[model samples]
Structures are given as C-alpha cells and as structure tokens.
Target: MHRTDGTRSLAGLLALWGATRLVLLLAVFKVYVFPGPDVTSDVLVIYQGWYEVLRTGTFPLDDVTWQYPPAAALPILSPALLSFLDYAHAFFVLALVADLAVLALLLGTGTRPGRTVRGARVWVAGVPLLGPTVYARYDVMVTAVAVAALIAGTRRPRLMGALAGFGALLKVWPALLLIGAVRRRAWAAAAVTAGVLTTLFALAMPGAFAFLTFQRDRGTEVESLGALVFHVARHFGWDGQVLLNYGSVEFLGPYVDAVSTGALALTGIAFGWLLLWRMTATRFLPHTLADAAFVAVLMFTTTSRVISPQYMVWLVGLAAVCLCFRRTGMRVPAALVLSASCVTMLEFPLWFSHVVASDPLGVTLLFVRNGLLVLATLVAARRLWRTTVARPRPGTPRGSAGEREGASHADADPQGLPDAADPPGLPDADPRGGPLSGARRGLTSRASRGAG
Candidate 1:
C-alpha cells in the first residue's frame, strides 16, 4: 500500500497513470471506435425518436418504449438542435458533450490525489460511444447527471440531490440514492432536490406521474441476474412460459406468481434498513454509507429483469465517484475494483461475440475480470468492517456528522480540504452513498489542504 506519509515519488504515480490510460484507450478503440456493438449502442434508440417525430408531431410518449423517465426526454433536443445542421452532426455533438461531462466531473475534483489523472484514464470508457452503438444511446446523458451528483455531493449535498434528481428523470437509478439521506440535514438536502425537479416535471410533463403507474403494469424480461435462478427450470423444458408472471422465470412457474420479485424486494429493504440502523446506532458513520451505496447499485443491477449492455455505463460513473472519495486506507483495493471494471468492459463491449464462441477465452477472461473485483470488494468490506470495530482516532474520543463539516468551515479554500485521515472530500465522493463524516487527530499539525 502507498503510505499516507506521501513519500511515493511523483514519477511512479505518473507511470501508473500512463499505463492505465493506455489500457483505457485500447478498450475504447476495441469496443467503440472499431466496428462492433458500439456501432449500434446509442444510435438505434435515439434515432428511433426521430422516426416518431416524422410520423407524429413529437417524440413517442406515454408508451413502454424507452421505459425512461420524463426528465431524460429533455436531452434528446440536444441532438435535435443539430437538425438545422445535420442530424448525424447533432448526435456527435451530444455524444461528445455527454462523454466529456463525465471526464469533467471526475477532473473537476482536482484536489483529490490522482483524481484528475485517474479520472482522465477512467474517462476512456466513454470513448467507446464514438462507435455507433454508444453514440446513439442516451447512456451518456444519464452518466452526466450521475457524475454531476457525485461531484456536487462533496459538501453541498442539496446540489448532489438535485443532480441525482435530474438523473432519476432519465434512468431511475439515481432515485435509489435518496435512501442514503439519514440525517435530518441530509433529508433537507434531498427534499430540496425533490422540490426543484418535481416542480419542473409537473410543469413540463403534467402527466408524468401517470407514466410511473404505467411502468408498474409492465412485464419483466429474462436478462437480469435475478432471472439466472430461474434459468434451470427453462433448461428442463418447463412449459410455464405464458403461465408465469410478467417477470422472467418465476420460481413458482405461474403468471400469477409474484413471489420471486416480492421476496427479493423485501430482502433488499431489510438489508438496507439493517445497514442504516446498525451503522448509525453504532456511530460507524461514512464508511457504512459508501458500502451501502455500492450495495444499492448491486441490488438494482442484479434484481432488474433486464440488464442491458448499457447498464455498465451507470456503474462506471458511480464507481469513479466511489474511488474519488474512497476510504484513504482502501486505495489499492479500490484500484483493483477499477481494474476489474475496466477489464470487464473490454470483454463485454469489445470481445463479446468472440468470447461467446471461444469458450476458454471467454471463461478465462471472465474469471480474471470478476475475480479481481471480488478481491477488491473483499478488501473494501474488510476496511469498512474494521473501522466499524476499531477504536476512535486519538484526541477525538467522540464525533458528529456536523463535526465533519467543521474543518471545511475553518479552511478558507473552496475545495473543502480533506479531514485528518485524508484530503477533504476524498473519502466521501461517492455519488449516492453520501459523504464521509469524521474528525482528525492532529489538525493543528496539518500540511494537506486539498480534497485528497
């Protein structure tokens, strides 16, 4: 592990940065820039809207098509603006901005160590969109709001919520982050976000709430992780196809059976409640929030009946934010998680078909990718668990969330200098998980003054 003593040479850090960049560039070109799925990812869906425009007066609405929230519909005009130019040119412009938005948000938190460089390296994942697949899709737009929420979440939490609210309008993932607000102040921040976005949703799309109801009546698909459990029954040639509920592969093998989804929902809620109650009552603070937020993403990703290829885009955005405000002690482990995400994208976006046909190549690649992430998750979980079990830092026998904000009050810098353990905001930059709340042991002898 790199020492907190800051003794590592800058050259070594830069070398690491350069290597990671090379990997990202290769991944981008392999997946997006070159001929492959990237050709179709974004263009097919977004261009469909234009088809609707030609047939009807406006884009398709009140339909099960995109399954997107109303707010997400607003950004389509970003590409539409280019109709005066060329529609293709407009798509490219929107794609570039959306892609860069992620990079900008990552680099915007410049004070955190390596955030800019690591951010720049991580930013390459978006490059694949230059390929037709991603460029045409709205994934980048969702990433923009998710990244914005992460960047804004550092200190101005209300800002975080608002950005998340905007994202929620697009894809519905950011809405889950609202559960992270435990403190009354955090609730205030989230409420402000709700108030602002809700007013806009009402004004712009008066019947938007009806869409939510419409979504509930919809059926599920077979692509989600939850459906994996039901695959065996299908393999056995169970004839419950039309008899099952809308969701894929119901355990009960009946259309009337909602038990699989219902049970999963109850367990998810219980798990979330336990994390919040156990961590707060025990005063475990920010690490709990970070871990919990990551789990929330996992739950959604795993539970959804449809895990599209584009879903990885959401994880990429949130994961970067997680690394930005990482537990100072978990740096290496966090990097490993990033490496796994990076490698997985390589297989998923670029080499997917080749992998499926080349069974050994595919399985080996999957092992390397998921294995690394599992290693990182274990390490991060250990760090969080240790913190929850360990003694308080010396000189600070007790602490409060408000106390975590006090250091920023004294620091004149706008970046919100890091707390005693690491650079300010460095450990709390998670998008939906919330911010770090801790106190330093030696503030009077401080030398650091940036986010990292």
Candidate 2:
C-alpha cells in the first residue's frame, strides 16, 4: 500500500482504539463507585487519601503507604487542583490526558525522518489491549515522560535526561534510559536528572526519604515472575500462602523470605548484566538506546519482587518507542511484549480469582504471559548483542575500518543496524580490494615493481 494510504489507515485504527479505550474506561468508572472482584482497586482510593494529606499541608507519609519517590508527589497531588471533580474522576482524567499525550508523541515520532509508523501502531494497539487499567493508573503519566525522553535522546540529549530524571522521581525505571546514551550524552542527562531529583528532595526533605524506608521491607509480590517459582512449588506441597502485604499480594510462610531474597539477588544479577552489556558493546545504532532501555526495564520488571500489571505499561511504552526507529530490529520483540501485556490484563481483574486460587487456568495464563516476556527479553538482548558486538562479515565493506565509519552514517532500518552494503550514491568497491579500489591497485603495482 501507498505510504499515505497506510498512514490514513493507521490513523483510523488509532481513532477507533482511542474511542474503545474511552468506552472501556467509562464502564470501569461506573463500576468504581461499587468495586467488586471484576474491578481491581482504583487509583482513586490511594489518591484520595493522599490528596487529603496534601491539603493538610503535609506529605501523605502518615496516612498512606506511599512507596514512590518524592517526585511522584507532583502527579499524586495534581488531582487536588481540580477540586470540582471527585478524586477518582480527576485522577482518571489525568491518566487519560497522559495516555493521549503518549499517543501524540508516538505519532509525532513516527512522522520524523528515519522513523516508521510501527511505533505508532504499537502505541495505538498496546494501550487499550491492557484494557481500562491503562487509564486507571498513574503509570501512563510516567510512560508519557518515558516516550518523550526516548524520542528526544538522539537529537536532544539534555532534554531527554531531564525528562528521564523527572520520570525517575515519578517511578524509578525511567532513569534506565540514560544507560544507552554515549558518555557525553549520558553525563548531560545524568546531571540534569540529578539536579531535578536533588531539587525535589530539597523541597520535600525528610518526607522524600520516607519511601526509601517503606520500600526496604517489601516482600515478593505474588504477581511477580519470581513468585511463579513459589506458585509452582505450592503444587509440590509447599506451604506458602498468598496474602496482602505492603499494599500488594505477597507470598508468606516457610522459605518465603528466602525466596524473596533470591529474587532480589536475581535483580542484582540482571543489573550487572546490563552494566556489562553497556561497557562491552561497541556498535551504537540510532535505536540502540531505546533497545537498551527496553531490555533494562524488562530485566528489572521480570526479576523484581513485584511485577504489577501497571508495570507492563512501562515495557509497552519503551517497546513502542523502539519500534519507531527503523534500525531497532525489535519488531517481533515489540509484538511479543504487547501480546504479554494483553495476557496480563486477562490474568488480573478477569481471572485473578483463578490466579489467587492457583487454579489451572490462572497458572496457564501466568505461564504464558511470563513466558512471552522471557522470550521477548531474550530476543531483544540477542538482537542487541548481534548488532553491537558481532563482527561484520569478512567480505562485507563494513568489515573495513574506513567503511565502518561510512556504514555508521548510513540509514538504519527497524532492525537497529545499518545496511551492510554501501549507501545510496556511494559506489560499491570490489570485494577483492580493501576499502578503496584505487588504494588496492596502487599497492598491487608497488608489490609488482618490487617483485620485478
């Protein structure tokens, strides 16, 4: 199909998807007044209590278990400014606005030179696929920030860092975006991030550190991938029980502590791997930062003690940004991530009872969802390794040191690597010759004279 036609079609699809998301949210809002098993806990419950605390001119430290960073206070307290609307309605509207903003950014990035509409496609489809939870949580706001930071990374490093730092305060994972940046860009971004974080902490002071204390004792949340080991262990007569702890479903009982510790250790290992990848990898494509960010988030999410459904939004948002870059080579990985998101919704708020009961269906859903995430993580990591670490083919022009510089300037595709062949308008050199045929011929003539 023509590109214009394809763009028009995608626009239509996005419109329909947005409308459906609105409908689903309205339906969810209607039921929020009288929540049941079908309706998961609303963000309003937490926000309302926190809003009241903010109104009293104090942090929500005493009233609510606010485990988020001090920067999170911005979004948490924002709904209070709209006092005309109930807290639930106001937070819902905020989430919707954030969601729309993310969509706009994705669409804008898609239109940029060297980007594709695939990123927009992922955004259009993945958000609603997660159902009303997309608008029912504040993660969408952080996601919007993440999308902005990633899209701005190549052209506006400082801006990207500032946004990422702001996002880090809202939720910690957004800071991971800086790891993919080059030394100078990473430094600029890190400095901006540190400034933002420092300013927020200075304002909040003692209250800002409250979240740190609160988070220190968290248990392994039942929905986390690591918890699956315990879930399966239950079948083998393990006596662990799932219960609400620290505002989440957690496994409690014999060896539960040990299991949670193991999960934390695994997370450390994941971070180490990311650090090693960053230090060792050489080739840096345009989409490399986004791809690395996705992998980092995936590693953190999958290995964490808590894999809240809302966390899936983080992965989906980054994956969409990754897909926008023509050279990211993450199309299938992005699809897998989106598919995992849909299954997350199914497992929660829908078949949660099954999951809670450790029933066959729930186990199967968790297995599938977690498995898809694992596969996406592995695939993305492999692609990243190949693009960054693998040597160019022996006969390929990119194998030459001089050609490597030229190849770096060539247009990259969605696979996150430049084409192996010479770029358009450039002559293809004979493979038997080194980088330049003239240089090879001159060397040959000298050798012939020496032989004579």
Candidate 3:
C-alpha cells in the first residue's frame, strides 16, 4: 500500500513537472509570449555573440560585460552541440535538459528510506515561479551541477568537491556548497579540481582570466537589497542614472560606489560568520551539509550588489537539497525562498519597467522580494547555528529532539562518535530505547491492566 502511494506521488510529481516545463518551453520558444521585456535577448544576442567569440579559441577579452569565470564558456558554447538548430532554440532546449537533470537528481536522492519527496516538489514548483527567465540564463546549468554536488553529500565527498569546484568555475557561487563539508578529502579534491581546471583554461585560452578585471567598475544593481536606498533617493532628486552596466541595469552615479562597497562589506561579514559556524559546529547530520550550504548561499546572495532574477534559481536548488532530508531545519527558509522567487518573477519579466523607473509598483516588488530573502537568510542562519553549534543546558536529559536527530544520524559525523563518557544530552550519545521510544509500550501496559 505504501509503495502504491509512493508510485502515485511520483507520477503526480512527474505530471506537474511536465506541464509546467511545457509552459516554460512555449514561452521561451515564442509560441506564447511571456510578459515584460524579452528575457530571451540575453541568450539570443549576448550569449550567442560570446559563443561566436569562444568558438574561435579565445575568451571575449574585449567585451567588458563578459565578467563570468572561464568555464562559463562551456554553456555559451554548448548550443553548437545541436548544430542543426539555431543558437537561441538550441540554448533553450539545453536549458530545459539541464532543468530535467536537476529534477532527476532530486528524485534519486529524495526517495530513500530516510529521505522525502518534498525536495522534488520544491524543484518542480520553484522553477516555474521564476517564469521563463529560468531557462534563458546559463545559471540553470550551473545550478544542476551544484544540485548534484549537494546530493553527493558525505556519502561521496570527493565527487561533491569535484562538482562544486567545476560549478564554481561555471559561475563562482557553487563554491559555497562546501561550507558544511567536514571531510578533508572534500577540500583537497575541490582545490585540486579547481586548480587543474584553472590552469587548463589559462593555458588553452588567450584571455581566460580577463574576466577578473571587468567587474571593477560595476554599480549597485537596481534589484539588490542595498539598491532600495537609491530607489527612494531617486524620487527625492538624487542625480543617478540607471544604465545598463556590465550587462545588467545598475545605478551609476554619486554614492553608488558607497552602496556597492557596503554590499561587499556585508559579503565579507557573511563569510566571517560562515567560517565561525564551520569551526564551532559539532552536530553533523546527513542533512547538515545541504542545510549549511543553503545558509551560506543565502547570506552571500542577500548581501550581493547584484541580485539578478536568475539568482533565485541557486537559492531554490540549494533549498530543495536541504529539504530532501526529512530532519532538515531549512523548511521555513526554503518556503521563504520559494515565495521570493514568485515575487522576483513579478519584479523582473512581468513588471520590470516599473522597477527600472523606481515607480511605486517596482519599489514594492523589490522590497517584498528582497525582504523575503533577508528574512530567509536570518532564519536559516539561526537555525543552522542552533542545530549544530549551540549545546543543550548543563543538566538537560537525553533524548531531546535535537539530540535524537544527531544521535540517529551519528554515522554521518566526520569525526568519530562520542564515547560512553560523553554527557547525557550531548548530540553524540547512543539513545538505546529512550523514554520517547518507549511511550507506546508504557501506554499498552496501562491499557492491558485496565482491561483486566
């Protein structure tokens, strides 16, 4: 009966995914026009132009907007694999394939004995919320790699590291997926993979590393958390121009540097907090890896100077990975991210003109979306810290919810489990049929005596 239910659930998930994805494909393919500005222009114009340049055995050295890492060339150039199709059509098809690949990875990991299908559900639902922009950006492909790495988790640390490294090269954000990896092997593997790939790209391509210099003059993007200050200031006669800077709309004028620098400082602080969490955290559940990664990415994303609409995909992917484990504390944060993705779609392709104009409707959308992200980041960080770093009270008894979670998954601990000498409520203890587990037996005995 359980298996039947599971099969039905899986079938339903697949059906929903197919329906939503067909809508996305139709939108991107121009069969059904999506609202707002044409999101496909990035792929049709910019990505295709870069593809032409990358195919000639060199990076886009002259293009200041070419600010991504060297491995970004692979996706830009991937459309050539479908040589029969035009560039934009082929890119959309590949994007859809990447989206399917992510769903498959989630299903493969989220259906195990201790896992849940909520992760697959999150992926199915979250992607469509961002609308067709999810398919137009190469970020979806990078997200696929990141999802695979998180699913690998502690069971396959080296594979996780390698994929994370490669994903970082693709977009630079996937490197945060390693924040919860306690294994030395994972770090070593990531360093080696990144080093080898960096060297190879540097040696083979004429301007493989030139992207480093392209972002030095970037301004605060209109959609970012810090951009709210400028958005309102614009109404009060602030002399700032919202121009297409470094391929995205940004505020370029006085005090823009200050806001951008503040964003960078916030990012630095986020890094500091993550490092402290890693050093102090002791509870290591199977889900901690994904939970920590989700938190880390949220911190960086929320504090970023450029919160592009597609950036929501990274959060959604990581959040889905966290929810795969039934015990993860990231459910609330994941919900917030999903909500933010919906709002992001509204602010972007739906009503982007208002946003760029700093109109009331646009300001409200940015506030709601950025506010959701900020709340999710804080809530996730607190939950992660409480679960892993904060210890129980001095005289607390065993078998508390947090303690049981850690004990049940103690096998996932990178360091060995606690010995008998450890404290009763310490996360590392063996419970051995504690009070909570024996409640049913106690209830049965009382009922039997009453009947007699």
Candidate 4:
C-alpha cells in the first residue's frame, strides 16, 4: 500500500511538472504571449550578443551590462551544443534541460527511506509561480549545480565542495551554499577547485576578471527591497528617475546611493550574524547543512541591492534541498518564498511598467513580495540559530543537563521523528561537549551516510 501511494504521488508530481513546464516553454517560444514585456528578449539579444563575443575567445569587454562572473561565459556559449537550433531556442532548451535535471536529483534523493517528496513538490510548484522567466535566464542552470552540490554534501564532502566552487564561478551566490558545511574536506576542496578555476579562466580569456568592476555604480533596482523607498518617494515629487542602469530597472536620482549603501550595510550585518552562528553552533545534524545554506542565501537575497526575478530560482532550489530532510523546520520559509515568487512574476514581466512608474499596483506588489522575503529570512535565521546554538538555561536540573544538551538532535531524523527508538541501552551524545557514542552515534552515522 505504501509503495502504491508513493508511486501515485510520483506520477502526479511528474504530470504537474510536465504540464507547467510545457506552458513555460510555449510562452518563451512565443506560441503564447506573456504579459508586460518580452522576457525572452534578453536571451535573444543580450545573451546571444555575449555568445558571439565569447566565441571569439574573449569576454564582452565593451558591454557594461555584462556584469556576471567570468565563468558565466559557459552558459552563454552553451547553445553551440544544440547547433541545429538558433541561439535563443537552444538556450531555452538547455534551460529546460537544467530544470529537468534538478527535478530528477530531488526525486532520486527525496524517495529514500525516512525522506519525503515535499522537496520535489516545492520545486515543481515554485518554478511555475515565477512564470516563463525561469527559462529565459541562466539562473536555473546555476541553481541546478547548487542543488547537486547540496545533495552531495550529505555523504560526499569533497564532491560538494568542488561543485560549490564551480557554481560560485558561474554566479556569486552559490558560495553561500557552503556556509553550513562542517567537514574541513568540503572547505579545502572548495578552495582548491576555485583557485584552479580562477587561474585557468584568467589565462584563457581576456578581460575575464573585468566583471569585478562592472557594478561599481549600480543603483537600487526597482524590484529590490531598497527600491521600495524610491517607489514611495516618487509619489511625493522626490525628483528621482527610473532608468535602465546596469541591465536592470533602477532608481537613479536623489538619495538613491543612500539606500544602496543601507542595503550594503544590511548585507554586512547579515554576514556578521552568520559568522556568529557558525562559531557558536554545536549540534551538526544531517539537515543542518541544508538549513544553514537556505538561511544564508535568504538573508543575502533579501538585503541585496538588486533582487531580480530569477533570484527566486536559487531560493526555491535551496528550499527544496532543505525540505528533502523531513525534519527540517524550513517549511514556513519555503512557503513564504513560493508566495514571493508569485508576486515577483506579477511585478516583472506582468506589471513591470507600473513598477517603473511607481504606480499603486506595482508598489503594492513590491511591498508584499519584499515583505514576504524579509519575513522568511528572519524566520529561517531564528530556526537555524535555535536548533544549532548551545543555549543552557539558568537553574536547570543538573541531572537533565545531558538530555537538554542533545535535545536539538533528537528530532533530526529523515522521518521528522525523535530518535528515541534507537537500540536500547545505548547512550546519546556526551554532556560535556565530547563525541557521540552508542546507538545515537550509529544513527547519526547512518543518516550522515545517506544522500538525505
């Protein structure tokens, strides 16, 4: 009966994914027109232009809008693999392939014993909520690499680090995926892989590192959290202009720099808080890696100066990984992110003109979307801190200190249940900050050995 139910759920998930992805493909392919703007224009024009330049063995040195990392050239040039199709069509096809790859990985991992298929559901639902924009951008491809890295991190630390390192070079945000990693092998492998790639790219491509200076004067994008200030200010005759700056719709007049600075400061504060969490954290459960990665990415994304619609893809992928471990407490934040993605689609390729004009509809969408992201970040951060930080309460019973110390790990199994059913007469973790032993140690070893 259990196997039959699981098979039915899998069938439903696949059907939904296929149906939604078919709609996305049709919209991007222009068989059906999506509202507001042509999201596929970027792929047809900007990405294709970059591909032409990259094929000549150099970066787009003259394009200020080419503000991505050096390794971004791979995805732009990836269309050559599908030589039969035009650049735009090939790019969309590759993007769809990457999307399918993520689903396959999530399904392979989420169906294991003690794990649940909730993560796959999150991905299947969240991607479509953002509309066809998911396939028109290379963020989906980058997200696939990050997801694979996180899944590999459970039992293959070296592989996780290597993938994370490669992913960071593709886009900068994947570097945060390693924030929760406890094994030293993951960090070391990441460093070596990144170092080698950096050297290789610098030697192989001219202006490979030029992207570092591309965003020196970027403003707060209209879709970002900081842009809310300008959107409201526009109604009061603040004399600000919304312009296409650095490839995004941004506020570029009175006091724009101030808000941008504030966003940067918030990002700094977020990093400091993450550092504190890492240093003070004690419990290292199987889900902690994914949980920490999800929290770290959420914090940075919410506080960024530019919150593009595609940024939500990264969050969805990470949230899926977090949910793969049924014991994870990130369900609320994942739901919040899903809600934010829907609003993002409306603000982007749907009602984008209103956003640029700072009209009521656009302003309301931005507020709700950014507010959801902020709430999700705070909730996720709090959960991560509470579960990992060792907080001994005052006047606690001395006899129960051992139990309290290991309470955080009690419900970290793949089934989201307490590990109290471990083999009898075996002890849990040591109360004095020593190593785990007995059945508890065996359970952790087993959990750590799996892909959960």
What lDDT would candidate 3 get against the real structure? Answer: 0.86
lDDT (Cα, 0-100) at 90 in candidate 4: 95
Off by over 4 Å in 2: 1-7, 31-40, 392-452
Q: What TM-scores do the predictions have?
A: 0.65, 0.85, 0.89, 0.91
Q: Which stretches of candidate 1 lie above 4 Å from their native place?
A: 1-42, 45-47, 50-62, 110-116, 125-133, 178-186, 218-220, 240-267, 270-292, 326-415, 419-452
User: In angstroms, how far off is 370's CA in candidate 3?
Assistant: 0.3
lDDT of 1 by residue, 43-91 (tens): 4444545345423433345444444566655665555667775554566
Top candidate by TM-score:
4
lDDT score, candidate 2, position 352: 81
Candidate 4: segments with Cα more than 4 A from true spot: 393-452
> Alpha-carbon error at 277 in model 4, in Å?
0.4
1 or 2: which has the higher lDDT? 2
Q: Write the per-residue lDDT of candidate 2 for residues 1-452, one digit (tens) a residue.
A: 68889768877967876786667667557753322253425565666677667666556676436888777777877887678987777888788888788888887878764467678778877887777777767898999999998888776777888888788888888888887876475467667776877676757555766777778788888788877888888899988788987777888888878878898898899888888887655566667778889988988888888888889999989999998876677888888989999998888767787888777888889899989988988898888776665354566643466545533432122222222222334332332222345554465346435433
Model 4 deviation from the true structure expressed as Cα RMSD, one decimal place: 4.2
Q: Summarize candidate 3's per-residue lDDT along 1-452 as a digit string, tens digits.
A: 98899899999999999999999999999999999999999998999999999989999999999999999999999998999999999999999999999999999887764577799999999999999999999999999999999888667889999999999999999999989887878888899999999999999999988888987767799999999999999999999899998999999889999999999999999999999888666566678889999999999999999999999999999999888877789999999999999999999999999999999999999999999999999999999988776464456554466555544344353432212222224333233312223444354345435433
Off by over 4 Å in 3: 392-452
Q: lDDT scores for all predictions? A: 0.50, 0.74, 0.86, 0.86
